[model samples]
Target: MSDLAYSIVTRDLSLWYGEFQALRSVSFKARNGLITALIGPSGCGKTTLLRCFNRVNERYGNVTTTGEIRLLGKNIYDEDVSLIELRKSVGMVFQRPNPLPLTVYENIVFGLHIHSPARLNASALDEAVEQALTDVGLWMDLKDKQKSKATSLSLDQQQKLCIARLLPLKPEIILMDEPCSALDVEATRQVEELMLELAGRYTIIIVTHNMAQAKRVSHECAFMLMGELIEHSRTEDLFIRPLDKRTAEYIEGRFG
Candidate 1:
């Protein structure tokens, strides 16, 4: 794909935690308005790379990163970049759903409260809540239950709530790190369907160990091994004909 077509581009990205190197000269791109899956074994840099997009890894102290990561043509590490704004543009969903203890309505409007310069009135907040939940296909189910505590909902619902919360922020990209790890098969399917629906409206990059899930949900796939990106291509192409032997082996169940 052309450079202009990508939402995220990384060049020689490397990271270290204390003395341990977690990523090594990794370079890849996630296309705009498509789902890209990062697949690799445990200890590989898939999660680390995902976190780099919004500079979330910096939260863990003693972390250091080198090279460049550009989002929408702007270098994320540039001095002028505001962390708050960057996070707003690039939202993230963790492995397990983490809903605030507030009501579903409150959770949906939480980001708006933080980012909006002026306080939104009741009607506006109601519209925002409805729109975000509708975008995530949760409006009908939760519309009447908006007053319910978010933590009281099912795990799948909570996860969807987590995703719905990001929508009100108008994020250009969404990063998911093993988002379905805590859910069952049926719940996983539901979330994947939601992901398909969310695609094209928001660029999504997911880190998953389930190769089948990657093939099923992503438009493109990147295979990583021991912190290095071995191969990246269309989902079908990479699965059928990987450019590197390591990628082929990992796909074939030979090794991670």
Candidate 2:
């Protein structure tokens, strides 16, 4: 049996961007300790759907959503829910690497110092930063650069640093949105490798426009079309023998 439990579960989750509907009451289970990939065309709501996992879409103006999203067995939409706690457990990585403007060392411990229950003493903060960096395979690269500004690193290094920063928060789930879109093939592969390596340690969900990359990095894949979830299946089955025509078409290089 799969050791995975559902990290996130949604019931009749739908969203509207003003008058235009983006998500259509889509419900699915995001298994813990595995990478689930969302693949779809532009404007098809892949990113919107991914944003819902961490309530990132709440920042949008005039956007509204209906239904319940359960994270770790609790309804996150409940009135008494703690947004900070929910967010801490579900970290998100954006399309572009967004590290803090402060020192690299500061960026990693920023969240812990700001929100975690434990006090951010000097030794604790140092240990947190070191552990976070080590988890992302970035500790050696950043060991000497801890005093340097976070923006001083290259794009790939910056992205890795962002991951290092997020890891210190000890999130149970990570949502990545087209993290490799701005990268070259080689750099993209590095991030992909990192994602796979981090899967069992943390549940991961990725939204990507690249079908091949989805197949490469994801254990399970969900394809979206015109605001609808066309199909979700194991990567091997979805690519080799799709049940939906639209999914097959997109996978076969026809139209997304």
Candidate 3:
């Protein structure tokens, strides 16, 4: 479904922290408006690969990277690329729920105030906040409590707020790295449900060690092992008829 208008493409992208190569010149296509899951055991470099999409890896020093990461047909590594704008379009949600200790409204408006200042007037900001929260199924939960301190909310709600904050910017893609790892079962389920609901609206790339979660949310999946992409296919095919012996073994619970 992604020949033309590819949302994100990595061409022989490789990264290394000093001498330790983390990604092995991996190349792949992440289609627009679909949920693509990255599944692998610990230390397999799935997380590292996901970070390259948003240039998050660039924040770390001594991290040398080689190759092109293209977003919406533009090479993101281009000298003139605006990291700030690029990041606004490619948002990220980390493993822990790190909502700032401010009012719920502040949590959502924080980025809007900084990223979309020209469009963040009173009425527009309110509308954007409402839409973002609504997208994550948290508007009703947080509407009345928008004035409440963000940290005072339950862990589940806090996580949702973190996600809601990302939406106001209208990002083209979302990178979630084990986003529900800290949540309880119910909260985790809610996040998973939201992801399933979000497919085809936002390009989502999530890295997870949870096989069930991967199967539950992904339309397609890429399996990785020790810094190499082992297989990429439809979720059903990957789980039901894995081509790689390692992928099959992992899915069958041979090892992580």
Candidate 4:
């Protein structure tokens, strides 16, 4: 049932936290193998929408959701859908680097240790660690530091390791919520470059308040306001020729 060209599609998706609505009938398609950015002012529900893809919002109390979310054409709301598998397919990275307090090798193979049906031997685990680190452009720097604690690395390296951990899960979609918000300019740039390198193989959706970062890294962008998606299009069109007044106003810094 997969839509070969699109990795995620949402139809009339709405969510409420107790009596407060967080997302209001958001509907859009994020193309396969591309980076899609969700941008809005703080508290505008960009992160809420991003969490929807993996159903992480359900962990918050008194939350309710309605409508449909499809991943590769399969409705994720279907009763048989597995939350564990859904999360594996849609990995997430947060605003700040949050590496596990374990060795780099342990961090990389942690998912496999927990999720793999068959117990993998040491060689398989080693290969997985190397590949994941290499994919995130960290193997050369950290290959000999396998026993080092992941949290001891620099902020940018820790962020890269956070991403590297996800790769071992073989995710199809990666979600980032203000991923570079905690890093300095050079660190942010390194993470951005890493994102660009990872794009073609996985569908990436990022929630960011930084419009310039959105312009720099995303292929497509969606603008939201007051829990509603205002506009979505190619990054250039959304920034240079926004069709919605709200989008234009936000882009122009008139109001957010």
TM-score of structure candidate 4: 0.97
Clashes of each: 0, 0, 0, 0
Which tens-of-lDDT digit does each residue in 15-72 have in candidate 1? 9999999999999999999999999899999999999999989998999999999999
> Which candidate gets the maximum lDDT versus the true structure?
1
RMSD of each: 1.7, 1.9, 1.8, 1.3
lDDT of 3 by residue, 1-256 (tens): 2344568888888889889999988887887788999998998899898888888888887888998889888899899999899889888889988899899888898987886547557887788888888998988887898899999998888887888898888888889999999999999999999988877768899999899999999988999998888899889999999999999999999999
The lDDT values for all models are 0.94, 0.87, 0.87, 0.93
lDDT of 4 by residue, 104-211 (tens): 999999989889788799998999999999999999999999999999999999999999999999999999999999999998999999999999989999999889
Model 2 TM-score, all chains together: 0.96
Which 10-residue window of candidate 4 scores lowest in summed lDDT?
1-10
How many Å off is the CA of 105 in candidate 3? 0.5
Worst 10 residues of 3 by lDDT: 1-10
Which portions of model 1 show Cα errors greater than 4 Å?
A: 1-3
Please report how far candidate 1 places residue 68 from its true position, in Å: 0.3
Residue pair clashes in candidate 2:
none
Stretches of model 2 off by over 4 angstroms after superposition: 1-4, 116-119
* Candidate 3 residue-pair clash tally: 0
Q: Model 4 scores what on Cα lDDT? A: 0.93
